[model samples]
Target chain A: MNSFKQKWLICRTVADVTYKEWSAYRTHSMVSIIVGPVYFMVQYFIWTAVYGDHPSLGGIELPQMIRYFGATALIGYLTMDFADWNLSMLVRTGKFLTFHLRPIHHRSFALFQKIGHRSLGFLFEFLPCLLIFIFIFGVDMRPASLPWTILSVLLAFLMNFYVNYTIGLTSFWLVQSGGLRSAFMLVSGIFSGALIPLDFFPHWLQMSQFFLPFQYLAYLPAMVFTGHYSLGGFELSIGQAVGIQAIAVLVTFGFNELVRRLAMKQFTAVGA
Target chain B: MKRYLDVYKQGMYSALQSAAAYRMNFIVSSLITLAGNILFPLVTLLIYRAGTSFPGWSLYEVLLIQSVFTMSNGLSSLIFGGVLWTTMSHVREGSFEVILLKPLNPLFFIVATTFSIDSAGLFLGGVSLFIFSAMHVGAIPVLYWLQFAGMFIAGTAVLAGLTLMMAAISFKWVGNSRISELADSVLHIGKYPLPIFPKAVQAAATMIIPVGMVGFLPASALLGRMHASDYAAILPCFLFLAAGIWIYRHMIRLYEGVGG
Candidate 1:
């Protein structure tokens, strides 16, 4: 119990420090206000143009499409982190050596830092964007089951961090991992249903998604928030989807642990 | 003009040397960029496969627009995209003084120094996609190709103008990297048919911001879809470039170094 308390305190302190550090760059975070709405506006125009008279396309009505995108933007604010970039840069620049002197693991520090950064993002990026989507964009921000949606979104946050962290560990092997990282980001963007609903994809691709963790990053939560859970041709209940998400998170976390151990052995700071 | 051309050639040589030093990274980066560029076309294919498309545009026609958009974007990024990051970093680090002290024009120096070889991926992908879609859409006359050449140059100019403006904003904003995201989101409207947008947005895209010229107008010219009013956008395109240059120069005067 004392160890748990100590760990909690460390996490809180790290998160607070991160929040304070990023608050100075609030303008950077606030850019989402303009970017999110503008992207939504583009979607608005495209969907409006496409759905001229049809009530729905690809099993989603016009209203639900707006909600899906709105949820995506908002959930993205809550969950997104640059952990991969941060870790990779530290490794590449030989800065990861500095963490060796500290008592805490770098992964723990990164996780705590993410908590703090995302805490700030929730306030600065998420809230204002949420209001914009609700009032200006008229997107129904209400969730199917608020508790379940929140739980699902939280799982997604961990899933995203673990996936990106795993990707970042690749820098231990590759001298220049930017290309690989970009490739992963591109694939993740598509497979995560951040680009379009996975339901719109061909059956083969949809079925393939069953084995990937990318869908848990954005699609499942967005679908749950929109009060429907259909992906890759399978309709799942909110409970079942979140349960799968939790399992994916555990599996990814295990994989990340294994990668981290292997990557640490390969670590050699050339300059430092 | 000859001096600037010489400087640009030297800059290209230096950039190519740097890329060669990291040959694997260069190749991988270019391929990733190619894959990233292919994403939108994949999205477009899915949209059309679902039996819905932009009204008045067939799948190949829309793909043509997207491919043109990619090419114009790729060319501009290769030429001017570096200006944004270079200006931002230089200004933030108080190295704008170094740029000012340079013998060549500051803007030219930044643009010349910052040539992006990675965008070759986008350019090549665009060319391939353009060829594939063009083959499907039937042959184009030499006259249309001539018109496309002119309009495509204008399209690239408009993007360069946008790049300069974003770079200029960095002088005041300081490390506002998301500014590019804002620009990209707004510019994304150009990737589609202008007619699909609201009347005001269409007008804004043509007259005020003139993003339409970046893709729609060029592709329309190629596809024989250009209306008479579309030519009006050409003047704004030049004006916008002038405005961007003016803004950049003006912002340079406003820059008070890192401390002040």
Candidate 2:
């Protein structure tokens, strides 16, 4: 119990420092308020042009599409982090050596930093954008089941962090991982349903998404908020979907741990 | 003029030599850029495959527009994209004064030094996609091709203007990397049919901001759909470039170098 309390305190202090550091650049984060709505507006025009008096296309109404993107933008603020970039830079620049001297593990420190950064994002980035989506765009911001949606989004946050952390770990081996990282980002953006709904993809690709962890990062939570859970041609209840997400999070955590250990072995501060 | 051209050629050659040192990285980075450029066209394909599309636009026509946008974006990045990073880094590190001490114009020096070899992927991908889409769009007369060439150059000018403005803002807004994203979101307006937008947006895209010239107008010319009013957008494009250059120069004057 004492150990757990100590860990909690460490987490809190680190998070506090992170929040303050990022707050200095609040304008950087606030750019989302402008960007999110502009993106939604573009989507609004495209979907309106596509629908053209039709009630729905591919079983998704225009209103739901609007809500999905709004939720996407809002949740994105809550969840997004540059763990991969952060960790890779540390590895590449020989900064990871500093972490080795610290009492806490690097990943734990990174997580604590993320908590701090995202806590600021929650206030500065997410809330303002939520208000814009709700008031300006008139998007329905309520989830179908608030409890389940909260659980799903929390899981998504963890899932996204772990996946990116795993990708960052690859910097241990590859001298120049920017290309690989960019490729992964593109693949994840598509497979994670950040760009468009997975339902829009061909049946084969949608089915394959069921087996990948990418869907839990964005699509599942967004769909749950919209009050429907369908992927890979299978429709599951919100409860069941969240349950699957929980399992995926655990699996991803385990995979990330394995990669982290292997990566640490490859660490060598060549120039530094 | 000859000096500027020589400077640009030397800068590009140096960048190429640097990239050649990391041959594997360059290849992979270029391929990844190509893959990213192809993603939107794939999205367009899926939209059409779902049996719907933008009004009055066939799939290939839309693809042509997107490909043109990609090429413009690629060329702009290749030529001017480095200005943003160079400015941001120099300002942050207090090294910006070094550039001011140089004999050449600051903007020209920065633009010349920042030529990116990675964007070759985006340019190549755009060329390939354009050829494929244009093939499906049917043969274009030399007249349309000529119009496309002129409009495309104008489009590139608009993008260069936007790039300069963004780089200028970094002078004051130090460490604000998302400025490019703001530009990107606005520029995305150009990647689709202009008719799909509201009248206000269309006017802003044409007369005011003129992002439409970047992709929509160029592709429309290629497709033989240019109206006489579209030619009105050309002047605004140059005006916007002039405004950007003026703002950039003003910002450089305002830059009080950061203290240690």
Candidate 3:
């Protein structure tokens, strides 16, 4: 129990360092902030068009649909971080060795700092987009199912951290995973409902939302405000979302450990 | 002209080598893009399932527009995907200096530096689907005689303008890459038949960014939803290309160098 607590503290310390390293520059922070909301606006425009003609596209209604996009937009900002880990490409190019000599868990520091940068970006960028959404739609900030909604959003973000981090680790094996990264980002958008509500997905695709971690990212919690996931469904969905995410994190860490050992061996041999 | 051709050749070769080095990733990226580009029709497909035209376009008419936009997108990225990194790391790292020191025009050299050959798969996928859809809608027209030429001019101008818009960011910021993602998203929107947007937003697509001119306007001209006089869009198209080059030249002076 004591050792577990120690590791947990170490993780937070690492996350904090990363946040500072990336967010230290005001200009860099501001540019990301500006881009996030503008990007969000284009997506918001897409949904508004789809809903303009019909009250419901797929089981989701107009008011609920608007709120779903609004909530997902905010929640996704917290999870859609990928840049720090992309440093692996830089590592291959010899850009990452400078950080390696530092006295820290290089991977954790790199991953967390990028998350920190993205978080600052989101706060500056998304806060106004959220307000603009509220102003336009008069969304009920208080959904009757607030607790589960919050829990699910947090779970969605956590699941994404693992999924995103593990994918970054692939750079160790692949010459360039940025291409794979692009594919992964686009796929997550579908799940996270960055482009369209998962509910609107054809029946087969929507079912995969259950099997994959995508539901946890965008759908289950989104349904919380949409009023689809009732009290009973909310508990089950949150449990599944968190559970799937936990299992995914474990599997990913397991993969990372095996890969790390092998990578170190290969890296050492090259040095020798 | 010979100098430009040689630059394009060297650029294309390195881009090919990058793809060759990472064949698996390259293949997967192309496949993934093919899926997203193809799947984009889903929204419009659902909308049109209600059974109506956008004043003059049939459902396939929009698909035709998507094919043109997507095909050009596929071709441009395949031919010049490397320019993307040049605007980011190259300039940020002052590798632009290596490029500038060469006798070649650094602008053309950087822009053609990396061809995303994988985008070829995407281009072919779009073209095949486009041809299939076009055939389903109508037999081949001698209009094909003019199709390739028309698409080339429109596509080249849009690519230059959009690439410059993204490159222009390096004037002030390092790692201004989310804007590149913005370019990708905007390209996705351009594949829409007429516009999937409200009138105001549609107007923005046309007037503000002029992306509509690239794919939709020209495709619309071929489809007869737009008259040939709409070809007047060609003026603005070239103007955007010129303006982008001018801005980039100015931005080049402001580069403080990649301190990071």
Candidate 4:
């Protein structure tokens, strides 16, 4: 019970520190807030030209497609993490030793830090963009379905965290993890439907998504949030999506643990 | 000029050696870079697959524009990457003094010190895509190839000039390291034909930001779509370089250096 309390304290302390650090850069955050909307503007134009008086394409009409991408932008930004970049730098410089001397486990510390960082982004970036979509773009967000959407979003966040954390752990063995991160960025951008809906992809590409965890990261939760995938819809319900996301979180977390243990076995501090 | 040449020769040697030291990393990074280049084009492909296309421009024509943009980007990154990184670090770290201390012109010294070996991967990727797209659209005449070569070089200059101008903005606001992203976002519009956009955006892209000079105009020439006025698109390359140099100098005068 004492150990559990200690762990809770660590999580709180790390979260506070990370929140403070990001909050200090108010202007930087403000600048980043508009980038998503700008990206959506480009998408808006492209889709308008593509649709060209057609009511719907790929089962998503114009208004719904706008909502879909807007949700994606907000959700993608909230779940994004540069932990792999940070972790790789730390490992390369032998700064990972700093975490060893701390009372908390490195992975847990990172998780808490990420949570704190994203909380600020959610407040400053996500909410503002959400309001923009509703007022400016006329995207109808079904806030009536908030409870399930929030739960699914939380699960999606956890899944994304584990996926990124696993990628970060690769720096322990790889000479440079930047390549891995870049490669993952391309694959995940496609598979997560952050760029476009996976249904828009050819049948083969859509089928291949079943083997990847990218869908749980953005696509499923965004769909659920917009009420595009409800209980009565052709897609799975909120409960079923959450169950799959939970499983993904567990599998990825387990893989991360295994990789961490193996990486530490061969770890060497090059400069230290 | 001879001294500048020597500096670039040595820079190329060091870049090669640095690449050799991290050969595995380089190989992986190159492959990933290739993957990233291919991924954006895939977005266009998927868009077309949904029973729609960009008006008046076929899929291959669109691909050709994007491929030309990539190749131009690759060329600029290869040659002027030193200027880009120097502008970044020199402002952020207050290391501009080092360049000022050098015997050669600061611009020349900055341009001569980095080879950007990674751009070779992008160059090859761009070339491959260009070939594929060119085949689909049918080959142009020999005269068009001559114009294509000239336009390609001019387009590269425009890319370099724009990059330098964006980097120069770092001097006034060193804390905004992300200033380059504005340039990136602007250049991204060039991957599509210019006419699809609204008139206001079209005007901004042509006159203000001028990303059209980088790819759209050049690709239009290859497609035999250039107007007489389109030949003057290369003129921005010179103007951009002049403006970038002037701004860089102006910023140097204003700089107080780190922790001042």
Model 4 over residues A1-272: C-alpha lDDT tens digits?
A: 99989888888888889999988764555555567666777788878888887888877888777777887888776787878888888888889888867766888888899888988888888888888777886777654278877877787778787788778889888846887888888899888988887778777766666557888888888877767652212367666766776787788788888988998886776444
Best by DockQ: 1
TM-score of each: 0.97, 0.98, 0.81, 0.91
Report the interface RMSD that candidate 2 achieves against the true structure, in angstroms.
Answer: 0.9
Residue-level lDDT of model 4, residues B96-186, one tens digit each, is 7877778887777777777889888888888889999999988798877878888787777667777777777777655675566666767
Off by over 4 Å in 4: A1-6, A131-138, A141-144, A230-234, A268-272, B175-177, B228-233, B258-260
- lDDT string for model 2 (A175-232, tens) is 5567667887889888887778888899999988877888888899999999998876
Backbone-clash count (model 1): 0
TM-score of 1: 0.97
- Residue pairs with backbone overlap in model 2: none
Q: Local distance difference test, per candidate?
A: 0.89, 0.89, 0.64, 0.78
Query: Candidates 1 and 4: which is better by lDDT?
Result: 1
TM-score of chain A in every predicted structure:
0.97, 0.96, 0.74, 0.91
Residue by residue across B149-194, what tens digits does model 2's lDDT show? 9999989999999999998999888989899998989998999999
Model 1 off-target regions past 4 Å?
A269-271, B258-260
Top-down lDDT ranking: 2, 1, 4, 3
DockQ, 0 to 1 scale, candidate 3: 0.29
Task: Predict model 2's lDDT versus the native.
Answer: 0.89
RMSD of 1: 1.5
